[model samples]
Target: MPHPATVVPEIASHLKRLLDFVDPLPGDVCLDVARGRGPLPALLAPHVRSLTAVDAARDGRAFRTGPVRMPGDALTAAPAAPHARADETGHPTVRADATALPYPDGSFSLVTARFALHAPDDPHDVLRELLRVRRPGGRLIMADLVRGNLAATSRDRIERLRDPDHPGIPTIARLTEMVTAAGGAIRRLDVFTVERPAEPWLADAPDPDAADRVREELLDEVDGGPPTGAKPRIIGGELWFTQTWAHVLC
Candidate 1:
């Protein structure tokens, strides 16, 4: 079995902010794109009528009492409550790619992609797909890292070194443009920064040497101007860096 993830303060705060931005309605049928381990699904289930969480990989483990199942092309074929007897949460997990959702167009009342935008091979295509799945006038929300111009280029380089699957983080302006191009009008936008500890953040890096190099670069910026544009600082004897997050609604 996979170990339970510890919810760090930074992540918790961000999730809270995202929830606030989304303000899910009780009648809304929501879809969480790239929802790994189902944090967003758990939080959203109470507010939304039904929640479907999708990820690229098919994991055997259930998340927050929801059954993990292979995604069907037709959402209508799935039972209204797949785990109604076993679990009251009633949300379902589906294995599918974000760039091409399995559900038909206008299937959901609300669609959200949080913290997973940077991992997609084609974020633009994924955003378009997300829009396609939403019903007319339904809300589409996205929350992800926004790169500042000062460190945008270098940040992408360091992130790719840390995670080979990392596509790249775009600026807030870039994200807005993508959303607009995907047939979404801006409803709301909230921008904030989170300070994350360096060690824990780098612990998951696949390449140790690359992690070290990225660490050195971040550390170098601690005393001077931040190199990657994320403000690096020493707080309470821990090396911390900032990442800007944008909660956008369309």
Candidate 2:
């Protein structure tokens, strides 16, 4: 069996394909809000001129590539680590919130929210902030799980059990209304079904002495068992994963 972290690279390969479909322009200055674990930023680093990876949690920010520890910017009130001001490409990462960006109006050519828009206290305020940093004719790309678009009842119920900080992932029609109403024009929208087949992980009881027992326990506490009706009958059976990607131009 392979280590969980060891499987990340291959998973990132698949994630890149999804990201490319949403934002394909090479050499574009991009902002990745809530870039947990840096998979998107790592794959995107080489493809673009520069990548600004931002997150509120310090633990969720950094990514290591070999001996070099590439840490991301932290968005706390009293900043601890100095922000990655700029790299060779002149694109630097900063610690900031989506609802109140730290840049001047129309500062970036491209702004992206991958699985991040679903956590703001106010999604509309976050949308307005995304538009604030984008230049005229620039683009904003958002990827999130669309509400009621789940392929499985279990998945829908699972999301409901998630943190209250999680954003209300509205349907496609609602997303369209929110974006255009906030001065962003909806250019394109894609729905990607993300299916995670049932595995032994779902059936077997967790190991009490496992290295990540605490972590596993936390996950379970937050969302106990499979989603209410989202599970399939057979173990290792096919399941559906659905996420929405919307491209908006400001």
**lDDT winner:** 1
The residue ranges of model 2 lying beyond 4 angstroms of the native Cα positions read 1-10, 57-82, 85-93, 148-157, 197-250
Global Cα RMSD, each model: 7.1, 8.4
Per-residue lDDT of model 1, residues 1-250, tens digit only? 1121233445656667778889999999988775354466667878878787775433432111111122222221123344222222333446677787888899999998766566534777878898999999898898777865444587777777777767777877788787888777788888777776666666667677877877777778875745766566776666777767778888
TM-score of each: 0.79, 0.63
Candidate 2 global lDDT:
0.50
- TM-score, cand. 1 vs. native: 0.79
Worst 10 residues of 1 by lDDT: 61-70
For model 1, what is the error of residue 162's alpha carbon versus the real structure, in angstroms, after optimal superposition? 2.1
Error at 178, model 1, angstroms: 1.2
Model 1 bad stretches (over 4 Å): 1-7, 57-92, 149-152, 223-226
- Screening candidate 2 with a backbone cut-off below 3 angstroms (N, C-alpha, C), the clashing residue pairs are 118-167, 154-229, 154-230, 193-241, 194-241, 194-242, 195-241
